[model samples]
Target chain A: MRNRSILIISLPLLIATLLVVMSLSITLGSASVDWQTVWRVIFSKITVINQWVEPDWADTTETIVWDLRMPRVIQGAIVGSALALAGAIYQGVLRNPLADPFILGVSSGASFGAALVFALGWQIMWLGQFTLPVVAFLFGFGSLMLVYFLARVGNKVRMETIILAGVVVQAFIGACLSLVMALANEQLQTIVFWMMGSLSLTEWSYNYVVFPIIAIIAIISLFFARELNMLSLGEEIAHHSGVSVSRTRFYLLILASVMTGAAVSVSGAIGFVGLVVPHIVRLIVGADYRLILPLSIIGGAIFLVGADTFARTILAPREIPLGVVTAFLGAPFFAYLLRRAKREYF
Target chain B: MLTISNVYKHLERKQLLNEVSFNVGNGRCVGLIGPNGAGKSTLVKLISGLEEPSGGTIKIMGKDIRQWSVKKLAQKVSVLTQDGLSPYPISVFDAVLMGRYPHLSFFQREGKRDIQRVEEVLEFTGLADFRDQMLDTLSGGERQRVAIAKAMVQEPELLLLDEPTTYLDIGYQMNVLNLVKDWQERESLTVLMVLHDLNLAAQYCDELILMDEGSIVKRGTSEEVISAQMLKEVYHASPEIVRHPKLNIPQILL
Candidate 1:
């Protein structure tokens, strides 16, 4: 009851925080727009839906706010929520708190796929403007299937085998990625920048494609939240309590993998958002997925929006990699949590 | 309520149980007493449908166990193992309410009756005060009680316990058995518990099945299954057996 009430209170506060951060994010870019214009442009666009009044503010200001920063902020929130949701499911299904979206080798495979596209320079437009994401998602999901099959001993995939398989697949893909990088020196910058993950290239088109994918997945995952709660206890206990262990594990794996694949494909492997957000949320709220899932979704969006804002603003006129910013913020918090927890979770 | 015949269980090319057979009547508490490595846990696993029997058929309530779906089967049977504690932090109330998983469909949430049932079980188990506390915050005995409460919330017709009191101190052992006994009578629950303590088994169980070398050596009332000669042959220990002064049940003293 206490936990439920805390959730009820914190959820709205988190949304308010997210809105505040997003508004602050829109105002913090290289071109500074006054708070009044920012609010006028937003509220006029919202209240006067079709008849958006020409902002008395400069055209550059309108373009900067609506054209550039808006999509980036939304992408940041989408990618953040997707990765964090996948991480919670991974941790629950594998019964390992350390498990993250990248634990199954999704990031390395995504890098490999994106690097392959760069090396080949095959400009065959498959999925309109987001061809790179499509290819990257397929290859990333392919690598996950490979690791899964390799690690599975029989009907069960042991924890040790999963870690070992992930490491092995990651190393193999890393080798391939380096070979591609060395061969295609001219395309190296494009590949490396994408691998570091940036929201700079985001457009409303990308949002149009990515938002529904993640939102639908997150909503579907909530239905299985209770099964995930059972899975965390132990497989046998879960089975005795009427969870079809193998089926639940399989469905959750697919759901988490799809979310990770989509996020990595678009954002080029944003690290630690998936790993850190769930842990921090679990600490604040308890480990019940019913609460953890929704809270982590909101918490992750807030975190990434705040981090991306800092990334674009920290070294003004020169942007740090979004991944670097997240790692910088996430690693210390992770270390603090590790020291504080003292391997309690392990 | 439960019947096993010629059941065989093998793992990694090693036979764990060979031609094990037993019948547990409805509304009776049966204790399975065995030495270490005697396949007591394996038998419990088979009965609970966690593992399949290598070569025999088991039935429950006159229906073949294999014919029932796992979810439906779980609705009628619940298992309590010693190591069933949640490693993650889960509130006692939420953990106990998970026992209603079988009754709920995929899209269904826990209804009011489910919560009421969990509260009743927690009250019966003396864990009502700790309902909002996390499982990890509870002590060993307290956690065991929570585990029992979780199982009781399942409202199963048959309960399978694999050394449920293995890690508890003696007082907790008695407490656990007393709780199980009280519930057995109140709910008319059929219990198949694996026990290490012969005296406690004799005191609480209506019948005893003594197992050795992955097979049942003897099974009958406490007086028939637990004797000085049988103890010496099965456990490789010479224990003096005496009748309890108040209960008239056989008690083993070493």
Candidate 2:
């Protein structure tokens, strides 16, 4: 009861934090816009309680706020949330805390797809098109299916087998991506940038692609939150508790794959947000998936928004890849968690 | 009521349980006693539908277990396997509440009744004070009790326990056994427990089934099954069986 109440209270606090971080992220970007102007632009559009008027700055503010910053921030939130949600579900389904969005080789597969496009100069053939993201999503999902098939042993797939199979597939795909990178010429930098992950290229159209897919998958994943909780106890226990272990696991894997594929398609290969966000949330709130899933979504959004804000502001006009910022911040926290983990926690 | 007939369990071509059969009546505590690796846990697993018997059938309350849905089976029987640990940190209260999973829909959160049931189980298991504590931080006995609380929250008609007290001190062992006995009497539950301690089984179990080589060697009242001859043949231990001076129950002297 108390835990439920705490969750009820913390949810709003988390949302409020996300909102504040989002506002700051919008205001602190390369445009050098002050908070007052940003607020005026936002409030004038959102509400009539405008204390200040920006008559001449409206178009510029509108372009900055609505056209550029809003989409980027929203994409960051969606990508981060997708990664974290996928990580949480994978960790639960696989019974491995270290499992993340890339455990099924989806990121590497997406990298392979994007690398292919870059190597073939397809983006030049079809400039300003959605082909790259679409291809990335297909390859990401395809690799996941391939890994799933390879991991199956007779009738059932053990957690160890899945992890080991994923590792092998990941290594194989990584090799392929490297080979693609080597074959490419002047476009190597662009391919590497995509591989490293970024939200800088996000546009308003990207939101149309990311939001509906993520929102639908997120809602579906949340419905299975209780099943995930039972699954963490182990497959047999979950089965005895009326959960169809195989079906639940398959759906969870697919959900995680779709979410990860979508996120990777947009942001490339952002690491650690998926892995670290859920674990940090688990530490604060216990391992109730009902609590963990939603909190992870909010936490992921807030974390990336905060990180993206820092990334944009830290270098003034220049922007750091969101992946770099996430890794820089997440690695230390992960290290601390490892150091603090009890002996048997492994 | 539960019935197992001609159950065969094979692991890697080795027969763990070969043609084992048993009948458990309603409101009865049936003790399954055996040495290590004697397929006692396997029997529990088979009955709980955790594993399919290689060839045979299990019936629970006049219905074949295979015909029952997982949720229906869960509502009928709850199994507590030995020393099952959660890999992640979960609070005792939430862990106990997991017993309600079989009773809940996919998107259903634990309502007030579920919370009340969890609180009752916590209080009954003496874990009310530790409700907020993480399971990883608990002592062995406390962890075992939490497991029991989880099982109890299911409110099952038939309870299957696989070495429920394997890791506890003597005090906790007694506490757990006493609690099971108390619940059995109060709730009229049918219990099937795999126990290593012959003495405790002899003391608490109304009837005991002694298993050797994955088959029942002897089964009767505690006095009938705990005989010196049966102990020597089954356990290969030359122990003397005597009636307890105070409780008038059979006691094994090793």
Candidate 3:
């Protein structure tokens, strides 16, 4: 209700922007391909009418479009949306503007899992490139549970305690990860590369795990958007206003943690996508989560897909780390928002 | 419509409310006056179901407070605290519309009737002009009016005001109190307010309940409870208590 046109007009526009970004990213790789060929490749493969537009493009071109670029762009979009949605939920539930997906120990926990996998060299290729992700997902979920239990006092989870627990857990897990890295000699670069985040090697299977969790949680979060608005006011007012404060907080925390876990487990830590995207949506629309939640979903996809595109082609074959590109763009945009919102935003 | 029988509240090492038994009749405006930390706000919280008392029974409309779900209790009771609503980037209309949160079910959006109620309350509270303005841009008086408007839209049988006038000046205090008084009479609403201004309490409240430490010290009309002796004993002060010329109720001359 804060802004109707945001949902009516801005939402579709963001979705359109996402589509364009996805297609453009699919075409802008080191092996350059024209729009027609990319569309032919996508349409033919998606429709299962392979004979419709085949025998024209190279095998390498088809592989680049369908196998490599398609999965990478699509995964980037989903991961971005998941992280940003988690970020918005975190900020709203905690009632803190600076909250992000990694604020809890999920990222560090995932990193620790990856580090252990690398240190032990357990490249079992489980689920065909899913072994490490499954381990990381379990650890990420474990870290969230640990943070929840630590933050809980008797029957309630206070925001300060949650943040404190997150920091404590992150530090502890981060140290463990460093120890694992110290122990590993040959796989240190691989560990560091994964930490930097890249979409160059995204497997199609990551979508199966990340997409459903993100979709279900995002839809449920929309259902609780009004409750989220109440929580932003403060706990007493929220409780007095009829929101079950503890119950609402628990749902949001668990939903955000799972969504964050799924995304970071597969893609490593994509910095600033979660931290910056929700604020961007809030800037364009007002603070109503009805708009912010949906907009952040599309906005995050657009941001990540575009960032990955830039990361992919900026150095041609040698891709820049996705984290570096996100930070380079995100920090300045955030700074600009900060200066402009000095008075207007509160 | 409200009852508290032997309500005792302890916050960790401190006993906040001790044997706090009180009954607010169907359509009465009661004032709770006490020194700081006298458990006034604590009792309000218990009634609103924000916290549970260590021991006791608190009821709204013959039903136990603990028996009411949060949303169900909210349908009958609304609490307003001093500077309660933070200056979030919410429009005045949106902030006031939040009152209908209890009435709407989960996955249920605000209905047309809810919007109508918000509009009515906005117009009633004279916040129609500021409806689209953000909360932070408003003056303290205007913001409190928004909070009252929000409570108005809730349409509760009992309104709990926890030091609702603490942050306002004398003019705003009167404006705010007069609004509540008009609404109380118009709707036969039950209100229990915590007030620091004893004079205002004496003027607006039908009956006054005085608390000190964790126990009720006195309960009567202004003429009965607003004596210099009671002030000295309860407030630890010797301020002169004089009758106001306009309303003929006691006014503290500090």
Question: What are the per-residue Cα lDDT tens digits for candidate 3 across A169-267?
Answer: 999999999888888999999899888887766877777777888888888887888888888877888988999999988988889888888888888
**Global lDDT of each candidate:** 0.87, 0.85, 0.88
What are the DockQ scores of the candidates, in order? 0.70, 0.53, 0.78
DockQ ranking, high to low: 3, 1, 2
10 residues in a row with least lDDT, candidate 3 chain A: A337-346
The CAPRI class of candidate 1 is medium
Model 2: per-residue lDDT, tens digit, B1-254?
A: 99989998898879899898889999999999978878898899888887789988999998899998788788888887666545446778878888888888777878999989999988887889998887778887777787778878888889998887888799989988898888899899999999999889888898999888888888898888888787778778887777899878889877
Ordered list by TM-score, greatest first: 3, 1, 2
* Model 2 chain B lowest lDDT segment of ten: B80-89
Q: List TM-score per model, in order.
A: 0.95, 0.92, 0.97
| TM-score-best of 1 and 3 | 3
- Residue B56's C-alpha lDDT in candidate 2? 89
Model 2: residue B240 alpha-carbon error in angstroms: 2.1
Q: What share of the true interface contacts does each candidate keep?
A: 0.81, 0.73, 0.88
Clashing residue pairs, candidate 2?
Answer: none
